[model samples]
Target: MVPDPDLQLQMVIKALSETVSTAVDPGNKVAQEQLHLSIATLGMMRSRLPMTRRFYRALAQDALTLAKDLEEKTGQSGALTQAMNDVGQALTDPGIENEAIEQSRARLHEAITDHLAQIDKSLGTVARDIVMQGSLGSIERQRAWFVESGFEPNADRIPAISELIQTPDHP
Candidate 1:
């Protein structure tokens, strides 16, 4: 059940775009919260999915650019600026092993779990299942890409990523 890499990439791009759009109104509390959660999830995906890294990076860059524009227009740093900075910092140096890397992985796992909970709550069980299946497929493809490219998978993160893939009923 491997999802198409291109499709998965497109989905991520869409998600990022939506996140930016939702964050456009600085006064919107719900949108701000969504932006925060979405960026964290995007960062997690960027770290875990090698094939989608470029797209994720592009999204992060776009958010940063948008933040800069908004700040210049408004003459003050806003939530968007802070959110973009957080996401950019997350994607900037995803090293294989380091205290920072470990912290990033932990944040990613927490974000993923929160996202799955939201999906299950808002979209119903069927949609949640579809998303989970797609995510697992995407992760498998990422692992395969790392192997094919002669890079060892990050040993510390692999088990955490695998844990996200496992169904509660199965293990």
Candidate 2:
């Protein structure tokens, strides 16, 4: 029987946790430390794997919001407009492949960056706020995913992974 992917990942994580906890050579501190790090990495990957599509979709939505805001400010209709349309189309496709979603997200982000560069110092408060909001949200979401890595001193402030992945922008 084919093992469910999520279940398989859980099994691997559990096994690795046990190995690092007990099976590693106690005298070999470096090996033990490396195994511990590996386990942590695996756990993080397991948490992120199922949410990849949702994460990308949410990013796409955020990019779309930023693009729309920038477009309104610049009043220019070209690459940004096309990028918005592309992302919108990607979001609407229930069975869209990961590659397509990533490509669309990248295009939208690039378009937003290019537009912002062109506007530079003239960007108004509203646009700056929108951009900052998106950036902070993305950073928080990433921190939430990597909290187990013991990197964030204020990890408590980070939203739960489920909360980040279940963004209102996507179903």
Clashes of each: 0, 0
Q: For all the candidates, what are their Cα RMSDs to the real structure?
A: 23.8, 2.6
Q: Per-residue alpha-carbon lDDT of model 2 for 46-151, expressed as tens digits?
A: 7788888887787777778777776776666588889999999999999999889989989888888777766657566666777887677666666787788888
Question: Global lDDT of each model?
Answer: 0.47, 0.79
Poorest stretch of ten by lDDT in candidate 1: 162-171
Q: Which regions of candidate 2 are displaced past 4 Å?
A: 19-30, 124-127
Candidate maximizing TM-score = 2
Q: List TM-scores for all candidates, in order.
A: 0.27, 0.81
Cα lDDT for residue 122, model 2? 55
lDDT of 1 by residue, 55-152 (tens): 33433343344334433433343434445456557656655334443354344434434444443244455444544543554454355434323255
Top-scoring candidate (lDDT): 2
